[model samples]
Target: MTSPPPDAFANPQKLRRGLSRIWHATGYSLQGLRAGWGETAFRQEALAAIVLVPLAVYVGRDWVQIALLAGSVVLVMIVELLNTAIEAAIDRIGPERHELSGRAKDMGSAAVLLALLLAVGIWTAAIVQRFAA
Candidate 1:
């Protein structure tokens, strides 16, 4: 028996189908987070944000500062979601101790750290300016 031609794998239609498959898989991620972390620290932090949002509105006094605060919160959540995706993908590849897998997870974690730092800086500046005024 002869193997299939390599060009078949490289076809543009096939690549498009693969991208669609990945897009559909994102629903699984949303479900996982809703059933897992959404019930724990994620829920608590989200609740805290909800509570603080009104107070921020009352005290924000400027549109730019409000946008900065909102954008910073969103950035943290976006980084966290991407980090979770990386960790999940690595585990799905293999539940074993491999150097590459560790590195991938660590790199994802580093991205989250940077996002957190950005959020801290934005919040600190906004709050200081708001209170000092």
Candidate 2:
């Protein structure tokens, strides 16, 4: 008989704790980012983040504003990563079309859209606050 599939939740990573776990986790996170870099949407957002984060300093009037501005940009990238992850997982399941798969992909896309809108609103407010009399 063929071997059964390994348990998903209880794997070797669970045994790690403290600094050792963090060190490995950080490496895994970087690897994920490298994978994310391959996606066009993620690459574009990263490029935008490169410009917007520095621009946040100029547009923000105070520390709070700067933090909000920078945080908003980061939020977009985070959401994009999550959306890409969702799409990747769905695609991995199979090439065949399924209702749930379409719904999940759509929801993931909607999440990215919402994040972008939020970032835009925050940046717009910050810009107006900095420039308006």
Candidate 3:
């Protein structure tokens, strides 16, 4: 049997230390954000977040309401990011189409859909509570 190829994460000791680790982690996160931003869906969701997050604050009467509204938006972004990562990993595995790969991607997409629906429901409930009541 053959061994796996070497990569940056091969050695645990090579990891950064202290503040350097934090700095590198932050850079990596920014890189991920940039990569996600390049995706059309992520860009659209991000734009929605930019609008909705502040609107949450404006529409919510209390801190709890504001947190619920804003948290739902963040949850969607988190789910989308995870979904993107899943698709990227599946793509990196191979170009050949496989049933499992398609299923994995579909499941990831479903997760994003659920998250988005939850966000919409949360926002609608909050809005109705604040205005319709």
Best by TM-score: 2
Using all chains and alpha carbons, the TM-scores for the candidates as numbered come to: 0.68, 0.90, 0.89
Query: Per-residue lDDT for 51-124 in model 2, tens only?
Result: 99999999998999999999998998999999999999999999999999999999999999999999999999
lDDT ranking from best to worst?
2, 3, 1
User: How many angstroms is residue 60 displaced in model 2 relative to the true structure, after the best TM-score fit?
Assistant: 0.5
Provide the global lDDT of candidate 3 against the true structure. Answer: 0.90
Tens digit of per-residue lDDT, candidate 3, span 1-133: 6443455367653455699878888998999999999999999989998999999999999999999999999899989999999999999999999999999999999999999899889988888888897
> Which sections of candidate 3 miss by over 4 Å?
1-9, 12-14
Ranking by TM-score: 2, 3, 1
Q: Among all windows of ten consecutive residues in candidate 3, which has the lowest summed lDDT?
A: 2-11
Model 1 compared with the native: what TM-score?
Answer: 0.68
lDDT (C-alpha, whole model) for all candidates: 0.72, 0.91, 0.90
Q: What's the CA error at residue 26 for candidate 2, in Å?
A: 0.5
Question: Model 2, clash count?
Answer: 0
Global CA lDDT computed for model 2: 0.91
